[model samples]
Target chain A: MTNKRVYNFSAGPSQLPLEVLETARDQMLNYEGSGMSVMEMSHRSSTYQKIFDDTKATLKRLMNIPDNYKILFLHGGATQQFGAVALNLMDKGRADYVVTGNFSKKAAQEAAKFGDVHIAYDGKDNNYTHIPTQDELDIRDDIDYVHICQNNTIYGTEWNYVPDTKGAPLVADMSSDILSRPVDVSRYGVIYAGAQKNMGIAGLGVVIIREDLIKPHKENIQVLAEYDTMADKDSMYNTPPAYAIYVLGLVLKWVEKQGGLEEMEKRNIKKAALLQDYLDQSDFYIYETEKGSRSRMNVAFKTPNKDLDAKFVKESIEAGMTNLKGHRAVGGIRASIYNAMPYEGVEYLLQFMKKFEEENR
Target chain B: MTNKRVYNFSAGPSQLPLEVLETARDQMLNYEGSGMSVMEMSHRSSTYQKIFDDTKATLKRLMNIPDNYKILFLHGGATQQFGAVALNLMDKGRADYVVTGNFSKKAAQEAAKFGDVHIAYDGKDNNYTHIPTQDELDIRDDIDYVHICQNNTIYGTEWNYVPDTKGAPLVADMSSDILSRPVDVSRYGVIYAGAQKNMGIAGLGVVIIREDLIKPHKENIQVLAEYDTMADKDSMYNTPPAYAIYVLGLVLKWVEKQGGLEEMEKRNIKKAALLQDYLDQSDFYIYETEKGSRSRMNVAFKTPNKDLDAKFVKESIEAGMTNLKGHRAVGGIRASIYNAMPYEGVEYLLQFMKKFEEENR
Candidate 1:
């Protein structure tokens, strides 16, 4: 209905690259002469298998994933995987968690159901605005794995460096920031991301796990929860989110065309800096999180006046800038600048911010 | 790719209504003036909530779902629900299963992992050619629930009537046959289907559970498996398969435009009958399933000789009639004609069958 496109800044199911959406739109009915939508194609079909294979390969290329690592396109969001991660990895009946924000807290809570989960570090005293230093972590080698959420979507904090797991395997929930930067695949045992942020649509979770980690756990009741079963089937143990995977393939292709992860990181840094730099200079606004730990994906800030913050959000929407309101968990204003968010969108927000601040002040 | 849309008839992840696909393509980038792809919109957004609400309402209307029945858009596919169903319903630690075909047998097998599962009736000994009569099912009030797969997609048989559970609630897996017909919602405790078959696409499973069946069992650990928790969140317990649910909405709208489920059933029956009538008249094609139990959604058959079956499958694909090969479990051919398959597609296959049979015979 609206002719003009808005700059979407919500976390998780946030903005996607327009080019990727266009590609998906073009292939909606007939995918590469298959004469069907990806949703309509059988997972067993060669057409879909190619889509599946190419997607995995593209992801591998973008992330520089090692051959020892298997990329799985599993059906279910990150929350479902919280249980699966524990069921599969917590073979010792104990795991350590570094709680950075909401997602890490949920991961720890879900893991508690399957194993003896220990919070190695908690940032709650700082309101999850900073990642803990290695000295602060009491990671035990006896624990099966050390879990952390690399980027906190809600709190606008990120671990700039991979935490030292003290010989325990590291598992990260990279849900909100998977392809936003380059990562050393060899550094972690498992990296899982729900495909709603900086990936594709919702529903599918991409779990990139080292082959050695896929284990046979007799304690696990559900067959789908068994990582070995899914790994062997190439995540086709059952029907997958075919269309989501296909769209993800398109997004991956888009990422590769945008010069892969290095280029993505560079662009992300620039985008984040453009907004963060402005906020730093504006006495009227505040970016409370530690500057070193600030996320390049999401920037949360607050105006000195609550009424101005409300007015800013309202007026921004009218000017076709949407989802600028911060999450209710920690609210003021948050602008998520995912890879898909163009520089021009940030400028659009900047223009509104300047005009709104001047008029309101 | 191809200008002419080839008829897609693979099992699940099968054909979607063209109207739904067209509507989706049209709105792929901008959804209803929101100025963002539905895929890009957050699950927490008011726009997506409206989509979620309207979709559930449309489904309730099409299915004539009772007020007490809560429809859920769950993350995992039907296979995932197999464990959830057993975990939730098998409160007494035992359940009875009527194994009609592959899916039902799998369900029974999975339920065994959670609790005691007894297969009261099995059709596989007879090549899954017929549904057992009510007397054949050893239904008892002692069991927690009686389970049935209403339609056998692979074996080409269907339960013509709901079996009396003898006071215990009935659970039905209607994956391949949902929306192909209508049923009284009050008869079953839980009815779930993977979206790929008669619904829109893969990744999401739609579960309609009666409120009273949402139990209070402390033993069930995974909060995602808890139906009440998901139903309470409106399937936003975490970010759902948002795009898949959006497509489901478009599909429901298409079904409504086609005069609702009654009209859908009528069209499906007519389409099924066209292929069935032709097969019955042809001596070369073997319709093995008992006529009384034949499915109006899937038609499975074979030629007199295995070599002829091979030839027909190979030549048919060249002629654009694909996925006709039988499941490896059953060596023959299967044509799944869900609600999306147009009458013309079946007629096209009929023409091929007529010509192929005449020439081969």
Candidate 2:
């Protein structure tokens, strides 16, 4: 095994806390003297039940979730929730979606399959570089819920202000930026995230929803996709992603020890500012995202030309950083500095960028 | 951290090989000099892609899967596949289900939500103690597909012979007995199993389907649940359960080194026979499953009385064998000796059983 740990910056399924990995390794053979790895234990077993309960509890504590909200540890990632959200909450057979970037566009498309999906705001014309202002959103009052992706991993744009849905339930896909900042859990009817980015690892989806919103859907949706079924069974409808939830619990504990979401937001802001400041001044680089819409989690930028961008990605990997390549949909560079990404990693990237700019010019 | 590892007898999310766990622990911090844990890598990167490709390749090699079939590593367990099976394959809006045990019953119930599910054979009256004979299964000629749970973890029954479905395609949920022995992939239209049992861990479902059967469904189903969508995307439809797939690859490699399916069948038969033989001779305990229907994976048995059964379950844990308690649906003792369960583990359980029998008697 290599002693080196590179700064990984590919959107979701990205970097996890080193402490969590260490703890997981230490208990790989046996968990808490239980004689089986977390992976090997039955989800129904008391030992694994504790891990499941503690993970849900810690996330609730960190987010200050209301008593009316229930946390579900599910199998599929946020992509699965794109359909589940619409299937479960489209009680009126209609919903509104704010299409800010790639993921939101996909979510709207999936939701359209289940019911009448109205695109309240479309950012396609602006190349997904801008999050729509509340005034620009054409949310329908009769819709069941208003859907929005809180942060766009591909476009590097995040909704700076929560849209007023005029009393309608707000469902947000916070896959890339959930735990990186403090969230008003009461504001949204549901908030779901994939556990590969700000949490711990892949294989798990964390969904927090207001208890009242989790009623039986009118359609014949899959039982596993029904929020009420999961809530009623306490997310043990079937065997969960046991090991991923255990690791997520470890990561949550680490976040708690590091003073929780407020502290995470502080660090994330600083890290983003360091890179944003450099990109703003660099003559050879271009940060396309609108100033007000820039995301603190995923910082997307690129060199003046495609060849230089390719060279930058290659040289960055050689300089002990990898996965800085932008998403295939939008080719350039994207440095995803999630909660687990150290401030030093972004500083290192900035230093490399400075060197590259000087050499390229 | 404890140095001692106990024998875990969980049905699914069951025991994994000790060697696989060691390899995982050794490379927890750095996976093959990639400078990141497998959990931290991007699913799109070359490093992570290699892991994904290698895993699919190893499983295909071990199973001797045909070129006419495609393997998909998906989220959610076999529970999700229950609905996906009908939603994707119920082109005629009708299907036949063989309800042999608890899981098959659940699968049928889920499928009913999507289509007209006909129970061709049900062993409920037999207390799930027998698998239906081929002559007993009344598969309809007009049905789109016939579904069956090949091995029942809760009931400890297995279908020893595949039923002919006339011209209709066959779909088998091999969640419990997959990889325990050789499987003729061409016999079934689809064979899907949750990775927690004989494979590796929870959070992943391995779907093996004939290319011809993966056609577009008539109904509006979630894209993630569509077999054709997954087959088209090469199972990278969205971020997959990355770490679980990696561990599954390691387990598949271990099975390969142990001489593939023939050797696995030999070891599994030997282990199952040892336990079955002991139960057969013991007057105090009863193995309820019909001899011809007994599974070589999960061996379910009980004492003459409920109190004695509780005592047996309690004493087994004290004897360093855990998860001996049966499913809540059927309260007794269940020792799930999947492929990773060593013969010595069964030996230890037998030793404990013999002592418990003597004391109770």
State which candidate has the highest lDDT: 2
Identify the CAPRI category of the predicted complex in candidate 2: medium
Stretches of candidate 2 exceeding 4 Å from the true structure? none
Evaluated at residue B117, the lDDT of candidate 2 is 93
The residue-by-residue lDDT of candidate 1 on B1-361, one tens digit each, is 4766788878888898988888888888898789998989988888999998999999999999999999999977799889889988877988999999999998998899888888889886798998999888887569889999999989998988988988888999999999888899899999999998888889989999999988874443676787878878888778889988998999899889999888988998899899899888888899988988999989999999899999999988878877889888887888989888999999999899989988999
Candidate 1: residue A215 Cα off by (Å): 0.8
Candidate 1 residue-wise lDDT, A13-58, digit = tens? 9899999888888888888787788878999999999999999999
C-alpha positional error of residue B196 in candidate 1 after TM-score superposition, expressed in Å: 0.5
Per-residue lDDT, model 2, residue B42, is: 86
Looking at model 1, give its docking quality level.
Answer: medium
Once superposed on the true structure, which residue ranges of model 1 sit more than 4 Å away at CA?
Answer: B217-220
lDDT per residue as tens, model 2, A6-29: 988878788888999999999998
